[model samples]
Structure formats: C-alpha cells, structure tokens
Target: MTVPAAPFTPAPMPERVTIYEVGPRDGLQNESAVVPVAVKAEMITRLLDAGLPVIEATSFVHPKWVPQLADAAELMGLLVDRIGDAARRMPVLVPNEKGLDRALDLGLEHVAVFGSATETFAQKNLNRSYDEQFAMFEPTVRRARDAGMDVRGYLSMCFGDPWEGAVPVEQVVRAGVRLLEMGAGQLSLGDTIGVATAGHVQAMVAAFAEAGVGVDRLAMHFHDTYGQALANTHAALQVGVTTFDASAGGLGGCPYAKSATGNLATEDLVWMLRGLGVETGVDLDAVVDTTVFMADALGKSPASAVARALAGA
Candidate 1:
C-alpha cells in the first residue's frame, strides 16, 4: 500500500493568519436585548480598530427568528461612513434569496450563507432537513459570487450536536464539499455544541485533506462550552489550519446548540498566537479594551479571561 503526502506542516509559526470577528453577527444573534443598532456598529468599528481583518456585521434573516439583527440594513448604513477604506472586509449573513437581495441593495459585496453539518440541527434551526437547508445555499452562494462578492459557507455543528449527539467526520466533509462546490470562497467548520476534543479536530482536518479540501480554504469556529475550544484550536493549528472565527469578549452562543458558550475569545487567541510569534495583526490590549467597552455598553462583564486580565480587572 502507498501512503499519501501530508496536506500541511504544523510549524511553530507561519507567515500570517486571518481572524474573522463574528461578534456582531454570530455573537449577538441569540441575545435578548436588541443591543441597539448603533451599539452593534460601534462594536464592529472597535474590532476593526483592534486590527481584526474581516467582521461579519449582521444577518438578513427573518426578524422573527433573530430580532436582535432586525436592523441589518441599519447597521450596514451606519458602517458605510465609519469604516471608510480601511481594508477591513465586513461580510453579512444572508439566509436566502431575499436576504441576499437586501445585502446587495446595501452595496455589501461580501456575504455568507450557513448550512448544518447534522440533519437534526438543521431541522431545528432552519425548520428544514439538511438537504433542504443546503439546497437554499446553492443559489444564494452562486449569486453572491457572481456579484463579485466573496462567499463564505458555514457548516454548523461540525463536531457534535445537541439533539443528535456526536457528528461523524464524514458528514462534515460532505457538507463542506457541497458548499465549496457551490462557489463558497471559504468554508467554516463550526463546533456549535463545543463538545469537540483536540483529537476530533485533528481527524476532521485530515479527513478534509483526504477528500481534497485545501487547508487554506478552511476556517475553524469553536465554542468554549466544555473549555476545549483553545485546545481544539491548538490541534487545528498543528494540522496547518490558520483562518479562524473569534468573538471580541468571548461573547457569542448558538441558540441551536444548547449550553454552548461564546466563541473562542479574540483576546485569548491573540495572546496564544502572538506568544508563538504567529502574526494575526491583532492588538491584544486593544481587543481587551474593546471587550471592556462592550461589557460596559451591554451592562455585563468581559467573558474572556485574557480580556479581563489584560484590562487589569
């Protein structure tokens, strides 16, 4: 039998990596408070000030589903004058054809669509089976790409599921392939339930590589519910994973994934990456300050340990 070559090298440091700040979109989607559209825009501005490259600004989903993001167009209008030519890309989430149309009307060129890695999660979140939800993404993704927008596809519950329990690695790979084939410029494997281990991270990356998915086109979005997020992220780095989605104060949760927490905090990941000499272009202190600002505006405390520590809280 012949062995295959490795897809990537787990080096101590690579040239650089891109971090997508999803606090405004994924982070606040489940929040009860409307968070005020002005506040949402400011949070995104602050993250960009902290050198975050790409920020998912808002989602054009039905207001009934996520009322907090009801002002998607309002938020984009606010961002237009504030984020002026800074080179920071803000991608809004579009759930269907109508959502994409709304995004295009705002002159938003970058867009993202989400589908589930599990059938059960899909049925609950989108009120449709996996195939149905993903079928919706096909035209949505293509239209975005055709409009010269960068298309990102998110495969939620990649590692485990609240309703169905452990998700198979093959299921994730297949969903990813479908999305990539649909013209998604990048694919994110989301650990929505936050039950994944570092071992699962390694295996999943290898499986995608085996299926011919390039590591460069992949991004990991891990939740810290079980405190395995950073560890799982470390394992992903060892497999040559680079791009990742993070929230400013560890402030996000999946309404679909029961008990899961916010994303792997941007401050924490910045600390780790900077300590290892990997360039993420993020200012750890700035991120901490931004989190503090977020906490004050939301009447809450910063969720990231690094943010609190660096803020001297």
Candidate 2:
C-alpha cells in the first residue's frame, strides 16, 4: 500500500524548494552515543543519493562542548576522499574564528555561524549578551567571506525562548538583519523550542520582509515539539520561503534547549510538498530507508511519524 499525500493544489508555494538536510551535524550532534566517523560519512553519501541538495556535514565546535562531533576533521576527510566534488556542496557549523579556521583547513566551501535572537539564550548558548554576540560573529563571517566561502547564519530562538516566554518580532528582525549585513548569504530562522504556530510564523516572516530582508535571503528551521512544525512550515511556504532546514527522520533537537524536540522530518516535509506540487528533488522512499538505517544505528526507532509509518509499511 503506497499511500502518497494525494496530489492537490494548495496555497501558492515555491516551484522548487531547497531542503537543507542537517541530520549529520545538528541531528547526530545530540546523540548520546558517538557515531563512528565512517558511519557519519556514509550517512552524508546516502542523503546525497536521496537527492538532498545541501547537507550540513559536521561542526568544528570544540570536542569539549560537543563530543559527538569530535571526529569532524576525520569525517570531512573521509567524505572528501570518498565523494570528491560532491563533498564541496556540504556545509559545516563553525562557532567562532577557531572553528572557522578548522573548517578552512579542510577546504570546505560553505560554513555557518550560529547566533541567538534573545538575550537570555545568547548568554546561555553563546556565552555573550544579545548585542555582544554579533561582535564575536563579525570576524568569523568576515574571514569566511574573505576566503570566498559561502556563509549561512543561524539565528536561534527566533519564535520563542525557554528563559524568555515569547520573543518579540522586532528583536528577531533586528538580529537577523545584522547577520545579513555581516555578509551571511542566507539566514536560517530557528524556532528553537518548537513553540511557534502558523500565525506566529507568518507574522515573523512578514516582519523580516518589512525589515528589508526578502524571502530569498531567509530559511526556516522548526522543531516538532508542539506538533506545529509542518503547520508552521506551510505558513512559511505560503509567504514565499523556499529554503527549509529539516532533519532526516526528525533526528535532532537543540542540545542547549532541553525543552526542544526533534526537527521537522524530511520525509514528512517532502510528502506535503509532493502533494502541493512543489518540487524538492527528494525521493521520499529513499529518505525513509535512510532513516530506518540510522534508527538502527542509534539503537532506537525513528522519531518521525511518516518515517515510522512508511518504513513499517
């Protein structure tokens, strides 16, 4: 029984959407068990085979902070040697100048810097105040741009924060614009706690648009904590957002935000887009199989509803 999402025209959606697969870095980083470098490499290759255009490979953050990705250099080396030019399209998260240096040494063409929208989250996540965090990111973004590497900026806690109940739209817009001004090619707005609803998502995207940042320069990263990830994604799509950050099989949550849960599942997003007649270039069946393989590697079942149902079927 191969049940599809039943193709139908919905609200205006982008003709082609770019799915930024973050399972390898953001997904595997929170795993309690450290996945072997070879296994991690294989996951990237599998994701590429499944037609994901942009896959975040690994992070160069210190091993002390994120032990799960301690094998960042090794993993990237294996991926480059195994996949050749395809590896160039993969981006890695770099927390600061030091991390950026590590990523540069590997000749990675794309890198992302993580920032926070609220003050409390900034202190807790980046060890800097909300305004001060930009000073830290300026040099890293500048240097990465200097190296001719494509830079993506990740703004966490855009919708709401654990310490701060609801984030102001103006505050989020301000911080996001700063990142864009600092030379970030694309800014990923993160609903770190999964507290966003469809209306809130539309309002936030609209606020950014009013701030002179178009949908062309923004991406949406949502978590499924309140079961609104897909709904929120739909809202973003209706507003002309074409890039979405999704994890394979809903593999990751924010390690810093304990209340956060798994991200929007790639299989689920692809199904909705398929029904809406939007092209993601993803094979849903291949993504489900990859999730099953990774779920077994993690010694647990996948958290994605679509993956569980489709894999079981």
Candidate 3:
C-alpha cells in the first residue's frame, strides 16, 4: 500500500551550525600565483581573529601537483607559533603517510585526509585507484586519531565526476562511510566538479542518512559553476546537515571540471544563515574586511556580491 504524503512543510531553523573556513586551502589551491608563507599565515590570523573555529591552513600534496602550497611545513610552523591554545583549529591536509609524518612532527592538533568519490578523481588527483588511495591514507588517519587529533574527511566530486559524468549515489556513500569509519569526525561532501543540482544534493544527503550516517557528521562544499551552489546548500540543509564550508570571497574552482567554478560566497551564506537565525559565530564585517584583503592578494575583485557591497567601492 502507498503511504499518503503529508503536506509540504518549511524547515525549522537550525539550532547551531559549524562553518569551516577553507579559504587558505581550497581557495588558494588552484591559483596560479604562489602565495608566500608569510602572507598565508597572515591571512589565517585574520580569519581566526574573525572567530572562524576551524580553518584549513594548507595542503601537503606534492609540489608537482600543487606548487602553490609548497610551503606547508613553513605554514604549519607559523601556525603553531601564532595559534596557541584557543578555540580555533588550523588543520593541514595530508596526502599520504609521508605528509602525515611531516604534520605530526609539527605537533598539529587536527589533520584532514582527502579522498574522492570517483575512481576518476582518485586516479587523476592522487594517481591511484580508489581502493589504493584509501589504503595509502588509512594509516595516516589512524595515527591522527591515536594522537587525539580532530580528523576531517573530504570526499571530492561528491555530486558529479568530470570523467565519469554523474557519480552513482553508491559511490559517494561508500566513500563517505569508509572515511567515517576510518576516524573522520566530519565528512565534507565536495561538489568538486561543481555540476551538482539541488535535486542531486537532496538525493545524496538522503542516501547517506538512510545508510545510517549521522547528519551532524556531514558537511556540504559546493561550487558555483552553474550558479547552483547556494541552491544545493539549501537542499542539504533542509535534510538536517548543519555544517558547511565556504571560501571568504568564493575563491576556488575545479582544476578538473571544465565548467565548474568558484565556491558559494561566504559573505552571502553568512548573511542568509544569520537572517534565518543560525549562530555561526562569524563576524560579517570582519569577514568582509578579510575578503577585501583576499581580493587584494588575488589581484581581482571578490566573487561575493555581499562582500563587494559591504566594501562600498
């Protein structure tokens, strides 16, 4: 027998939310310009001063792949010196056991392991099969967990895969579940190719939930390629996921997805969420100032309309 559906209802305002600032990592990963370690450290200080809790400081991928972040060790050193015991966290990305060892030597309190939702992205980004890639980082995750560190899981291309087109829901769920079981405190679902729609977002979130994954353990990372990031985010939020990542000025893009573009503007997300009464603990005006600083660093205007308006240029 078919169950009758209740009338549609508006989503209740979220009680609390986590905003992980990814400006230093995702925002700068694709930039052609090589940002100095000092500059990156300063930007991070500015972000923490604005009260963002968890800021992704940098990635430790091979310089061949992301020459922009070659200063990962230096960046980590600077962070430890500047960020004493505080509510803020600056987790660095580790591509393998080597990267993990390097970060552990620096005594980091948090670290992240990156995995992709598709074989194509896994092979393309890390030059390994999905299984092989996960195997490579498994030890890294274990070490971080044993050290009492907060570990985050990132599943790239969660919505769509450039080489494979739409990724099956099973593919993403398998990847997400693996990471969660591997000791990831939060699983950040990345729209790596930036081709996801609201409908797609709804399906993926539902599948993960139905699979018995906790919504609090999930986060959404969207790209505005088709200008659908905010819409996709709204869809995920409607399903009870509370955490979302944003670049201050929408400062990122897919190196793999041709039509994929920048992140949904942090300023815009903050405005909308705050208006909805969500407590993000971020200062909108400070975020605008930092966006302007980031714009100056990028040598272009910020992608955020809200940031631009606040600057009053």
Q: Candidate 3: where are CA atoms >4 Å away? A: 1-10, 86-88
Q: What TM-score does each of the candidates earn?
A: 0.94, 0.98, 0.93
Q: Whole-model Cα lDDT per candidate?
A: 0.84, 0.91, 0.82
Worst 10 residues of 3 by lDDT: 1-10
RMSD of each: 6.2, 1.1, 6.2
The C-alpha local distance difference test score for the whole of candidate 2 amounts to 0.91
Candidate 2 wrong stretches, greater than 4 Å: none
- Candidate 3 clashing pairs? none
For TM-score, the strongest prediction is 2
- Superior candidate under TM-score, 1 versus 3: 1
**Sorted on TM-score, highest at the top, how do the candidates line up?**
2, 1, 3
Model 3: how far residue 47 lies from native, Å: 0.9
Better of 1 and 3 by lDDT: 1
Residues 1-313 of candidate 3 have per-residue lDDT tens digits of 1111432335775766788889888888878899888888888888888888778888888888888889988887777777664422578888888888877777777889889988878897888998998898788899888988889999998888778888899889999999999889999999976788988888888899889997888999988888888788778877788899898888887555555678877877887776666778988888888889988887888778788777873
lDDT of 1 by residue, 267-295 (tens): 88887776566788887777888889888
Using lDDT, rank the candidates from best to worst: 2, 1, 3
Alpha carbon RMSD to native, model 3: 6.2
